[model samples]
Target: MRGVRGATTVEANCREDIFRRTTELVQAMAAENCIASEDIGAVIFSSTPDLDAAFPAAAAREMGWAEVPLFGTQEIASADGVARCIRVLILWNTDKGQGEIRHIYLHGAAVLRKDIAGN
Candidate 1:
């Protein structure tokens, strides 16, 4: 199994923004890796402590990803860590090597993974 990492930031702490941004990040992760929901073993989401208006997993379920296992948690607070950030780790069943996997970081979260975000 391979881990497909992705992170995105919501402009505001609202349900609409959370859903939209989460969906965008997940879609990009799937598209970039050329995988479907069935190819995913599980999806884990972490939101910075400041973001609690909505759960990112709800956005995944709203995306018709009913069969995929989903979990959500709040990230440990850090003075220098990015805020209003949502991160996702998708456990996938694939033959792709670690170096070949694509990790997506969009919006403000891009600063968290500068090496792989814009690539």
Candidate 2:
């Protein structure tokens, strides 16, 4: 098993923005890891307190992940935490080693995982 991490930031707390950014983040993670919907055991998403317009999992469903186990949560409130951020942790059934997994961080969320963000 391997876990893929990804995160992205939105400009505002709107449904369209949330869906767009979350979709982009999830798609990037899948592409980078070469993951398929069937290989994904579960996906957990977290969003900063400021973002409450939509659940990130909704975007996954729109992307055709209807049967994949998905969950959503709120990030701990912090004064300096990234705003309008959505983070995802995908549990995948794969033989790949942890070091081989790719972690995606896009937009302003890249700063949250600078060491592994690759950009």
Candidate 3:
């Protein structure tokens, strides 16, 4: 299995905003990697301590990923880390090599990992 990573930031701690941005980040990662729901072993989501409006994984469910195993957790507080950010790690069952995997970082989260944040 390979891991595909993605991250995005929210402007506010509103449920709707979190859902929309998290969905966008997930969609971008899936589209860039050509990921299918069944090919996904599990999706792990994390957010900065500042965000508590909703779980990022809920956005995946809204995208019809009901069968995929999804989990969410709050990130340990970091003084220099991005705030209001949602991050995802998708353990994908695929033949793609580690170097072939594309990671996505959107919005202000791009600064978190400029090495892989083309999208």
Best candidate (score: TM-score) = 1
Q: Write the per-residue lDDT of candidate 3 for residues 13-119, one digit (tens) a residue.
A: 99999999999999999999999999999999999999998888999999999999999999999889898999999999999889989999999999989887784
Off by over 4 Å in 2: none
lDDT of 1 by residue, 28-48 (tens): 999999989998999999999
Model 2: what TM-score?
Answer: 0.97
Model 3: per-residue Cα lDDT at residue 5: 90
> What's model 2's lDDT at 20?
96
Segments of candidate 1 deviating more than 4 angstroms: none
TM-score per prediction, in order, is 0.98, 0.97, 0.97
Misplaced by over 4 Å in model 3 are none
Cα lDDT listed for each candidate? 0.95, 0.94, 0.93
Least accurate 10 contiguous residues by lDDT in model 2: 110-119
Locate the minimum summed-lDDT window of 10 residues in model 1.
110-119
Candidates by TM-score, descending order = 1, 3, 2
lDDT of 2 by residue, 11-50 (tens): 9999999999999999999998899999999999999999
Candidate achieving higher TM-score, 1 or 3: 1
